[model samples]
Target: MNLLLMVTIFCVMKTIRGISLQKSTSHTFEMQEKRFVRSLVNQARLLSDWTEWSACNATICGIVGVQERYRNCSIAGEISVHLTICGQELHQAKPCEMPCITNQAVSLGSWNNWGSCSVSCGRGGVQTRQRDCLQILCTERFLQQRNCIGQNTCPQWSQWQEWSECSRSCGMGGVKIRERSCQVRRNTRVTQVVVNDILKRVSSPRQSSIQNVNASLCEGGDEVAEDAFPCMTSSSCRRNWSSWQPWSSCSATCGTGFSSGSRVCSGRIGSSCLGRPARYRRCYSPPCWSSWSGYTPCSISCGTGGGYRTRRRECRGTSTRVPQYMTCRGSNAERELCNTETCPVWGQWSRFDKCSKTCGSGRKMRTRTCVSGICRGRKFDVVSCNYQPCPYWSQWSSYTCCSVTCGPNGTKERTRACRHGGYRRAPFMNSCVGEWREQTNCSMHPCNVTPPSVFDTFECGVRNRRQTNNFSSSLLRIFGGQQSGPHGWPWQASWQYKNCNRCSWSHFCGATLVAPRWVIIAAHCIEESAQSMNHDNPGDLWSIVVGMHRFNEDGERYFIRRAIVHPNYIYRDVTDADIALVELRSEVPLTTEVVPVCLPQFSQPTVNETCFITGWGYTGPASSVSSRLSTTLLEAEVPIMNFTACQMLSPLYQEHLNSTNHMCAGDPVTAATDSCLGDSGGPLTCQRPDNTWYISGVTSFGFVECGTPGHVGIYTPLISFEEWVRTTIENNTYAAC
Candidate 1:
């Protein structure tokens, strides 16, 4: 029954009590109420599943937001007042947060119009503009400067010195080094000043003070003092013959024999020279004894009378032409006496000796000495004895996978067992010399921390173009790469240098856009550029081009406002800590063809995951100077390899690999499938399960050979420096318009 029926029953009972009804009627009403109550009490109540949560009520950041879900209830039986049935909860609510958003009018600072030149018009006049950032609103730049008319007085760089000879004489494992000095030029006078002051600063304290004053006047100061480029020479070379040395004396005394003479291939020392260096010719030598013939069956076998044996040898000459002059040196016959005097009677042999070993293969021996130094037969003897197997340790089992993707908290274990006769047994359990179980630390790389929400300045990890059938499948090296479709990698940014003619930009390295005004790249690129300029900052001479698919095409270009290399990075040394953050002069306009890539999360890519590398780097074995850099961006897929597996690919890698800061990846089975020259600072992007791409690594260095098999590319994993990247971008984002 429903609730209405119980109400009716209660009203009827009250009416019966108010009037002078018979006791039996009143009792009957009470009994009926009791029965209804019992029925309601025993019945069950059901509630429908909760509805989906409502959208957060709050839209602004930093405010508490709420979401609610609700359900409907249903009853199966009658209800009464006496016993109450419990009701199920029908509504729920939860707290949530809204995504962060910035107020552009407040956060974005603007530059005031350029003030008039200090003077009417002259090369020495300076024009300045103040970056009017609300100090309370922005933390970036506040002032800027520019030349009014002609270029400012700056240090002039000398012509690059001729490239030195290749470090190696053969193969491609070599480098060429060259250097240029910064010449301080004031007005029309060329002053031979050591801008870096390496000599003056080290020689005397008095000279150091003078050099410091002059260094401040130089344009961009040098950060790195040297520059090097990889070079290659042919593996094979023509043999350049050298004069032959005098022949050695004849090998033999009189008859014909052989003599050898040798010469050297002196061209390109240390390089492989084809053909033999030594030659042989016949010479005269004396006659010699060849070999003695076997002795006749021992004369007088089992004899008491004395007997003798004789053997003869033949004499040989080197040549018949010299036989008359070559006299024989040694005798051709030999003789020996045997079975002399009467032979003594042999004694009986003694019992065999005890076996040498208790188990496994061993030896035993028995001996009988001669009675009177006249015995005719053998005296001592030995024979094989023990043949049983011994207990030994079995090979260790493969180690287990690491517990964590990255961090020192992970560990792995393996085990082995003692065995006998190739099978484990009770007797062999304690015979093994080593431990039964072995454990080792693994995946000891630094862990990545989630960055602050403020750093999310742009939409990331999303690509607009759909991959086509022609898109290459796997990655590691880019040698076997395919052309990337337009806007295929929206975050791809080219680090270009303005050529001397200032007519076109030449790409030197690749970078990944992580924000509208921030990019991540290898540190060596910045160091190399600094070494070429006299000013302390090299960003002025560089441009970052985004949204461009091919060289010689137009793109959204921006100059680097400032650059910060990882603190641990050593200039010109790219083996470790090879990461840098570059801030653009202005924010890039976000579009389908221009976007940023997502930074890596705490989790790392799986070993089998196929990551991609896209760049205009050299796709052939030729050096960067050989014009092998591609004109269009190319992409290839490569799988992640564990430290052990990566290092085992090459002995050189094993010696230099650092598991904590570097990631090893590539198509180890495919030749020319790796990043090469000009590919440095490119992204090693990996796709997550959500179809978003994350910048897992930054291309640092690889094998000298463009894409030789068994040589994987080395990338900076960034886990160790992720915090630095986040802080650098957050603290130094370009605030000036």
Candidate 2:
């Protein structure tokens, strides 16, 4: 019934009882209940198949069976609900009135009428067929049901106007992760370091014994650990590890030859430090090298022309190109092999004006070119050569080939990649092979090469557009103020000096100008030296082209003094922590665009309330990062924790999270999300009251495929080591001369 009519009926009832009905506490539910009653009545008329009772009047009472029994309600929207019974809803039951029995009325009936009493019992009902398909019976008798009379008329004229107040008490809920509980039986058990390297090292024959492995104890179950997931039970939990992930097990205890220490190693198969089977597994390759490890150089087809033969093995290179392994998935018989004498030939345009390179045999030679003088693009399938801006006439008529990338200021190639032979004589490896007729060189790389200008291509945008949307809508991103600023350009935010001229090349990832003569970046970006036509190699990758933001274009591409990734950044295993520190061939002037941000002051701001993160990642979720650097603010309130609180987050850091190694932050209650994508490896800068900024986290790691609610971006906390960053740069950096 409508709240108005119900109010009228309620009013009439109140008057009949000589009781005054007044506005009860601030009860939204009360008001909504009245609305709900009206909605139910309307839905009965408009929604259900029951046309017989379009306007039914019903009395709604709390389960207590008393008028004005409800205290009050705070939720908005309709508080009262209307039950619309369908014809199909009524036909099977014979209480015949099974759809209409009133509760008080039902209790007053006998066995024969009692079964009938349940029909539409007025509270709620159940209509079910008897064991025999032929006999249909239904009973609906909920104490909370309201009685709707015939023709849907009001029960009484005064019933609608009155309302009672109610309170919302806490529903059953609470958890506690007390300190002493999660203590990693450290004092009682053994603890050892099995998977301490960058990627969890496959267990060696000597590392298989599991005795004194002092397993790190997870201290608590009540609270979720930082970098950890909520534990479903009371046993143990760990999160945030230097190089470990947590996995679940039935026994609550890890076995020997398996990960005794609890670093839930994800994504690959293998044992932890003690050399046990992987806690959880997905790897299919044999342990050690490729199951093809016993490989011997075989002249299977031993041919002259294009036919070749070479041993196929694992080609472990760090480049954006799809790893040879990923591209060679499942082909064990036709493994990869390669010719060692292979050197990709180069073609030049105007000495070095164009950034050009070719990949063939299979893969089309994708190119990154400056359409006009601007960084836009157009590519052609041609041989390898320097990548240069197309000739002014090159709009449609002019085309050229490239072998290497050039520098903007006529400097040397910043990144030096060399593509060897594309065809692998071996089965799957991307490496070497001899010719018989032909063989896929699994070792030959660049199968899925990410060219500098690949983003400028048409198809990529279509594929990744959706991810971009998801990224934009993420709640974690909203809090970061997305504003452009006066706080100097990010490229030049570093306190160090750099020289990147955008005159000659393209295809450079990210880099930091560490000093007047040095720059730092991921080695994977410059893995290949250079390659030939119809063949792929790592060489075609950019040569540390510093200044140019757009791919395929050149600027002051600096020479690479050296590329050094932590020996551990091997792609497999827990690569979330793959970090590399690069040294540039030479530094550029510290202009407004290339200036540097100061490194974190040692030990200061060990823990702070707020921090900032910035990146050139795509504006949308799936999109590649734009050429320019953009920044966001991430302010998190962190808590100080002891050993167990820390260990339960992840076992690798029992020592780190404790007194010496690790410094942690974050709380599970806040559901703080960390840097998802587009922000990897960037600095997590903590800002203080005095305006000084300290690097707290290195955009380290997180699940590659993200989206867990409470999961946030994980960073390589800077507090763990003061001497490392300083010692590495000590003599190399000098404040502006």
Candidate 3:
């Protein structure tokens, strides 16, 4: 069995040799060569343990290689055998006469095609091939290995994995990492080894492992993964801020102050802001003041007593005309010594003039000159002189008798003539300043008479004395029946400065006659006039025109005894407490042409009640003072509005509405129905159920442009100032009714 196995192996070797001779590729040759070498190693192992065979000495040749002959060789022969296999030899011996062969060298078979490279790209790899020897006794194996190149590249970083968790949380800093696996692509089209094979051949000392990367490079790496992020943990992120609001009204009207503003941080949660939240800057608002006015005229003309003069100052803000009185640091007024000179004195009276009367009695006049010029007294005089009586018409004889009694009419006659003696005399005698004989209607009324009602004294609602002319009627028709006739609004008063040059009729404001001796006006009007004059007495400069519509025409003008402005009144960009009362020097007659309006009771009507406004102000918004002053009183009906609603109507109203002291009224939808310039301090009168008119409000101000749609007029509510009015009238002796 052993011999048969050996023979089988030898036969296999021979067959492999024959196959290798026909193979063309280096790979095939290398494979066969490996098989042959393995076979020889196995054979040698078997020979070392051989038990049934004896060694021989002979020149081993024939089919194998030749070697020198040996004599007396044992089973384990010491003879040298030259068996060439692919140009290599193996030392071993067998029985002599084993076929002596010549000692010749054998070349290796042609190389086969190279195998695939170990790597696809980027460097190291190996390839192998070999040829085979055909002899059985040859022990050398024919195989080779050489370096190879691959068309493909070695494995590299394809893509990185997602970042891992941070190393630390809630600290000054933290770290995070990510890794990628090396990969190799196979080059199947080229003479290269498979990717797996090339990777295996690399034998890299680096294990298949991860790489560390700086945590900052990772997304969201700056923040900790857990809620316990230590970095700026105590600090919270800040939100953005809006633009600053308008600076608040100055703490004081003048002097230094600070205006502060703020901003917010724009950072992520838990991030700290490294700056301040508020910023501040210095601010200054100096009081606006007028120059000191000239000294006023002395109070006394001539006397031992001295008179005083004064000057005043006012504070007007830069942005607005605010009346900052105390805000002005300097004294507003000053007084100094006035006129001390004595006046001229009149001399003694002279002889009287001749008798001036022709009958009954007469009078005389006398005059004296101020020749000494040291006294202030009258320089003229008068006294009775003539004593003789003149003969006039003597007493007439009694009537003969009554013609009738208690009838439709009755008459009685008497005859008389100029008398010289105790009887009738010549006709040439002079008569008194009247007719010598006179007759009049007698018994014009019956013996019994009825008293008249109080209403009978004056006419009410008698708007026009005659039919309106065509032009006025057309105007009335066009203006929605708002035109009024002369003396239509008896209580409406035109407020004017005496002989003012700015306007044609000296008309500047309007007022309502609430009493025979008192008129209501706006404080702002008085203040404005006083400021313009600078130290001039308001009363001296103003006059009240009553009982007339046309300011240029005939009207009862009354001197203003005094003007009492409300203490709380303010004349700023917005006017508040805008009310005042003016006392007339003399009382006006309460006739049909001049009457007083009723004062409102403590309780008043609700909003939306219809009321009437009357004034000689502008007929339209575009009319100038000279052209617009109505020759006849203008009247319009408006409804009272809620205070809040009026404020919402315009920004101007919002800034001016003093809810406690003001009311709003107007036809907001009508373009030509609102009170315009020159209407301030006019009356807003409402008629009660009894058909009696009551003064409800005093026009304070309206839009400068007059009748703007959706805009209304603001007035000083009379009811709100009822107590004030009563107290003011009672406290002031100058006020009379």
Candidate 3 structure quality by residue, lDDT tens digits, 380-490: 777776545676565443342344433336565655554432233335433343445555343322335443322233434322334322235335422232666657677
Error of 2 at 233 (Å): 69
| Decreasing lDDT order of the candidates | 1, 3, 2
Global lDDT for candidate 1?
Answer: 0.67
Better of 1 and 2 by lDDT: 1
Q: Write the per-residue lDDT of candidate 2 for residues 497-536, one digit (tens) a residue.
A: 2223634332223344444444444323333213211111
TM-score of 3: 0.36
Quote each prediction's TM-score. 0.37, 0.29, 0.36
lDDT of 3: 0.58
Ten contiguous residues minimizing lDDT sum, candidate 1: 78-87
lDDT score for residue 307 of model 3: 72
For each candidate in the order shown, give its overall lDDT on alpha carbons: 0.67, 0.33, 0.58
> Rank order by TM-score, top first?
1, 3, 2
Model 1 over residues 320-375: C-alpha lDDT tens digits?
Answer: 67645455666877777776656566666787788787557778877776665367
